[model samples]
Target: MAYKALYRTYRPKDFNEVAGQEHITKTFRNALKSGKIAHAYLFSGPRGTGKTSIAKIIAKAVNCLKAPTDNPCNNCDVCRGIDDNTISDVIEIDAASNNSVDQVREIRDKVKYLPGVTKYKVYIIDEVHMLSQGAFNALLKTLEEPPKHVIFILATTEPHKIPATIHSRCQRFDFRGISIPEMTKRLDKIIDEEKIQIDSEAIKVIAESAEGGMRDAISLLDQVVSYSEEAVSIEDVHAIKGTVSNEKILVIAKSIAENDTVKSISLLDELIMDGKEPQRLVDNMIAFYRNMLMFKNVNTDDFEQLIYKNEEFQKLALNLSNNLVFYYIEVLNKALHDMRFTTNAKLYMELAIIKMIDKIEKQEIVFEDTLNDLRSEISSLRSEIKTINTQKPLENVVKNKEDVPESKVDTFSKKIINDSETEEPVVNEHLIKAKEVIVSTLYSKDDIEEEVPNTVEVENKILSSDLTEDNNVKSEEKDIFNTSLQEEKKVDNIVKYKTFDIRFVEDVLNNGDRELKIDMIKKWYDLDRFATVDDKPYTKMITEGRIVAANSKLIIIEYESAAVCNRLMKKDFKEKMKSLINKFYNSNLDYLALPKSVWEEKSQEFIKKWRNGDKDIKLTPIKNSELIEIEEIDDEIEDMTPDSVKEAINIFGSDNVKVKRGEN
Candidate 1:
């Protein structure tokens, strides 16, 4: 006897032994128990999912000496012979190598013969999609109407390639990939029986790396056991698979979050040098950050679902914001995509690391700048408080009673107290009370004095100064108002544009008139002929865009350059182009402009939605009023009657159009 691979040594012997396929197994058991087996069966799904194993099991169960039993009695001579492949009744064919009309004809001829040992003959063809067209034709009638004692089982990973006529004749059983938990349990059974010492996490790692395939998982476990000196570990699995360990991934992520570019690149170089793949490293990093984002958003105690479940990783998750985690995932995902096209994935990974660090540093700088601004504001507020506290009191100004009128001083003090009581309540109660105290102290009854005589000159000086200040303020305000008015008029001339509404684009794509679009596209080439020197640049802008969609009322254009698209979206440019189209094509149509890349993306989405028949996504017409800006020219045009329309146009340099008196 020779040593065998773990997957082969532990192949499922019966329906009960198969993992994660209870639906198919249970159905087959019932069919076998009732003796209602189909003559031909088709099994399809991903590789390593037990399609072939289940086919063999069905053959054994149906051919068992105890004829009507669901489970095979392995002790029977017939079952024993079939299991060991000594029996001529069960035949397994690899269609990859034996895919020819002659080979299929031989099977078709042989299927008519009775089983040598068992009651029925079973012909199992694996990878049946590899069979040629001629071979399928030859096998069609035989597979459709095989002998009463014959059973034909076909299995393929790609079911789509199988002919529909063949598919219609057989009972199809789709085998799904085994889940991680199920694979883990099966591997544990193998490990226990073989008495292989291994860490539980190592088994988990192997299961995850297998990617929903039990055979691959078992094979990985075997390789790890062979490579290890003693107990297998998670590091062993990562090393074998060229994947980064959770700890290393955590360190790299922390380095990125800390903006330690040098350390991150150093670790990346070390990993790549140690035979870890750059793409795999990027994938693991992305997974790490994705797990972090999940941990940040979801509240669960199950650490098994996450790649990194340590306390330090949790702390990192808390420290990193959800937005930053999202950004990290985005960068790494882009790197993963870019790495597939290039040979030098190391450069892309380094660039991605640098980008992440740059983002972190920029965010930190912005935070520091915000902090400095807040500090400056607090300092200014404190300085204002100090200035208010040091101001001279009113009593000091009124110490010379003859220099000021006593009745006037009493009136000023009374006004201050009255205003404080009637004014909006101050948020700070202490400030309000402080003003009251100062007013009461200044207007005390004990400090009263007689009114001074002949204060006419002082009042005249005060009145003259006040009048001069008022006149200066009024003159300044009038100048500012005129300047602002002129600026506003100039700004209004440059018509402002708004971002294109995506809904309008969807409507145009779904309901556009193809003939109208073609007409506009043909007319678009002749616009250069009408271009004068002044309007040539604008005409060129319109001509460069491609008309993507159009109807009687609207036309959509796409420009390769975003800047050109934005310029064409301007109200003035749009209006000028619309007028040109109307004049030349005799159609009044509004224009919508989008960048080429944007149109491609939107068109793809629209096509997908259409294919899915998404009733929830319905298109509605965009009113021309919503798309167009009706701007009024506020700049005054010279008033003219119909008689002087030519003179007015001449004076305005022949660029202005003559308007009727009432229209103006």
Candidate 2:
């Protein structure tokens, strides 16, 4: 007599009526037909996938008046009573609410009794994974060897939470999400039966929004129908869901692809003014780009799979390269992620759009290409060095300095011979050219001033003196020159340690020793007082930060603010901190500074690598003495039952490890 919601009113009555999941339904029918029903059944999958519905159907089929029938006779009194909840033989339990050892023990105690006025007794426990550990233990024995007349059906959205022991005893059926097409077809039938007027586009909008859940689709349809007294339109669905229209999304994507920053920002402002959420807009843009990418790659004629038609997708995809499209997707995805923690979502979205346009414009000057060029130059230099080693000795030319006229030698070589009186050596032409290239390519003017010195004069002095002297002096010059060259190499290595970014963090996390890193962090924290300059405690300024990762040579520290980072970036402060760190470790180590936000991003990236089973990103085990001591204390406290001991362990990590004893 009362009006019911569409999902409830159209609940599937049998296996044939259930939408999707025919694999599970067909198996149930076959098992029922052959009279080989399983004692315990576990249905697990995403929500609204018919796990509970299939459980109810199986119950009716087994308890139907017609013995061992695949289809339940709904017209029969036995089926009618079960459907009305009047039959005592069938019981439905919500394990989420009654998830306790006592409740499970009650079920185990009652499972031995035979069904009354029915062929079999069925117990359906929904959200069974919510049951406590003790409750699962209680259910385990009964589930393993249930009475012949009793049938247990356990259903959950997350099967991974269920213990393997329970899983081993049950026949598990995984229900999959309903497809969009399947959902659309079902909605069409429902509209036709209900005599409701709705546009096909509106049905599609609801179906896509449902995200592969029939119940959700039906509920959305019902809500939209209530909102529009007449035929429902796509606009109504969009307004109800607070989503931007596909046409607006297309326009935004087109603006980005065309590098129209002004147009993109203006349209974004309009959307924000019109109550469109910034995060939602970002998500829609990401989806639009993803669909364009699919159209570019997948040669499918099915327009249903795409959000836009083929022609529209073609026009957009043609204007964008696959690499650019991927880059846009990554930018939008990052914006979407940042929107969650950011207070000004609209500002972030606007900046994201600007960045996309900037990236597209600068796509010609890719960083990867720059790195490749650097690599090529380095290889060329290596080859040049090898060539120099095989060439005729310059010593012979210098040995005949007296035979050649003054004008014969070049001014550059004459200057080297004249400058030999000074302690500085004249660096050879090859080494000078190499130094120029390194400075030009890798360092700025200020860095070059600090890096390469007047070593050329020093080299020239050694060569000139050695060519005009005895064997002992020549040998001494050779050793002195070799020492100077080694020092230059060390300076080059130091230049390579500039500053770290996300890539460096990733590298350290993947390849750096974990225990050594933890040890370094602990030592840095302990030696904080010594890291000070000009009476300002650099350590205190950096104490708010943390060392997230480290290697033998480099330690990555993350600070909460730019001020702290800037303070630590001071030359004197950095030197003092580095000195302190070296003192503790007894080895030269460098500290890399990063913002907290950047650290969080890199940490998430590293975690994803770990999850994907990346061999390079191995998670380092925590084996520091401090942690070991805490663990030992925990083991000792396990046997203590006093409330004081429990509270102490909970607060101080151990019952016996106290900051202070009682005064008495």
Candidate 3:
């Protein structure tokens, strides 16, 4: 009459009243009706999953005033007394506290006694796994050969801890966690009977938060009812659980789609500061994206089926690419998994959001590249048309042995080289010969020496010093050679990193030893030892990559993502990995990390050439003192027309000049 929690007040008195556990209930009911009750029974499952409640019901059903009944009629005096805990025949024990051998021995000694007010004396032991080994041994004999009038019900969350000797003697029943729909139905019934006004969505939130435990669901429902002034809303559930609303999750998704890193992170910080759980936030975001993806693929007008149905959500589903949504789910799922091992959950979520933003930026870059490709194609077409117009008159002039200007010959030669088609048209032999002569004349060694005197001086000094062993060189020239060597040394001393290098892959393949790769792979299991420290991020990154090729002096690792490859390519990461591997494998071996896509392209090329009987493969080793870092650059050829050629083309005029090839 004072105050009882929903779980205690609504405890099922009959076997039929329990939800989501019809299998165990039906079995016990049929057994009780047929008088086939076991002398000792063991029930094991998760907490708050009706293990103890069902144990009590079994005791009452067996001892009810009216025998031969499948369930206890609470109207009877015997059932009422058992329910009120005033009966002497039923004994309930918390084995967690009374887990000594003496306690179990006392139970064994009392099994011969008759029931005082019921048909059978029942002993209910909770958390039976907590009993000591000696206690289990003491109870084993009694359980194996219990008196006809005695009944024992043992309940435990962890059944593995119970000894096999005891387990073999009892009837074991494993209870499963309540399903979501079943839990929601039970919670709905409680809310209806209690006359509590709450939104249907709020009940679902509570059920989900309970995670398949009936008692937990009821407890959360009771708490929410008490906290709300009137009808409980979904917001109230979110507030109680420290999770964000569906609308907030939508906003975060939009921010990510827009590549707004600052906004996404700011919103995340606010939620974390407001006592919202980072793990729950990531989960909700993942669900949001998942629903959006479903909406795109599934033909459903009922917005109720999805978690979010607002206009903003619809727009996002319409606007966001399917690929981006998939990536979002992947990143959030990884963050959710990683958050369990770290106390700083917020950091991981923030990093995940940043990664999504970067993905969006990369997508935009791809789109821009596609547009540039279209423009390049159009320009190439126009140049082809101009070539057709100019080549006609040039062919006629060549047939007549007309004296063409040197500029005109250069223009014609450039067009012939720039043509995309493989076949060359008929042209005057003299014009081709003159073009070759002019190239030799323009780029003579004397001209190069005048342009870059330091380079020529260094080359001359190096040859003279090498031939004479420094005896024929002047003191001034010797100083120049030393300066050159010092400069080269400086360049070689700078350390660098690259996102991907074909040379690295090639070097490993040329010297790859399958036996060495297998040996190193067997030793990769030792990597787990480095995982305990926080400073070894590269170790974790290394685990993400696979050892595709290996040799005594070099190794090639392939990763699924370029982002990971880029991270592993940092100067500090390289040094740490090199030192770690050297110490770990007891070898001074260099390693390369390449994205799977790049590796596939390059390795396939190598295989094709190797299959064609090309055995001249070579290794391009990275200097230990310097590994040059190259930024990702567009590989398309750049314009490199010589000044003289450009001047000649201008004199010939824009219309007369058709297509002209740029020097490499």
On the 0 to 100 scale, the lDDT of residue 379 in model 1 is: 64
Per-residue error for 18 in candidate 1, Å, reads: 0.6
For residues 199-239, write the lDDT of model 3, one tens digit per residue. 88788778767767899989888887888998999888888
lDDT of 1 by residue, 1-664 (tens): 9989999989998887898898899999999999999999999988888999999888898889897988888788888888799998899999999999999999988887777888889999999999999999999999888999999999999999999999999999998988877888999999999999999889888887887788899899989999999999998888788888888889998898787999999999999999888998999888888778777887755524536468889899888776668778888899999999999999999999998887422443333344466577656544543343256333433343243333433344344434534443221123333434433343324322211111222322333333423546545655676687799888867745335666567667656676677677777888878766877777887888888777777787888776776667766777787777787788777887877777666665665565475633554332232234334456678864565777777788666775645554
Local distance difference test, candidate 2? 0.73
Full-model lDDT, candidate 1: 0.75
Answer with 1 or 3, whichever has the higher lDDT: 1
Which of the numbered candidates is closest to the native, going by highest lDDT? Answer: 1
lDDT of every predicted structure (CA atoms): 0.75, 0.73, 0.75
Candidate ranking (TM-score, best to worst): 1, 2, 3
For model 3, the superposed segments whose C-alpha errors exceed 4 Å read 257-259, 279-345, 360-664
Write one digit per residue (lDDT tens) for candidate 2, span 415-487: 5555444433324433444434553454446644643343333444445554445557655766777888999
Error of 1 at 215 (Å): 0.5
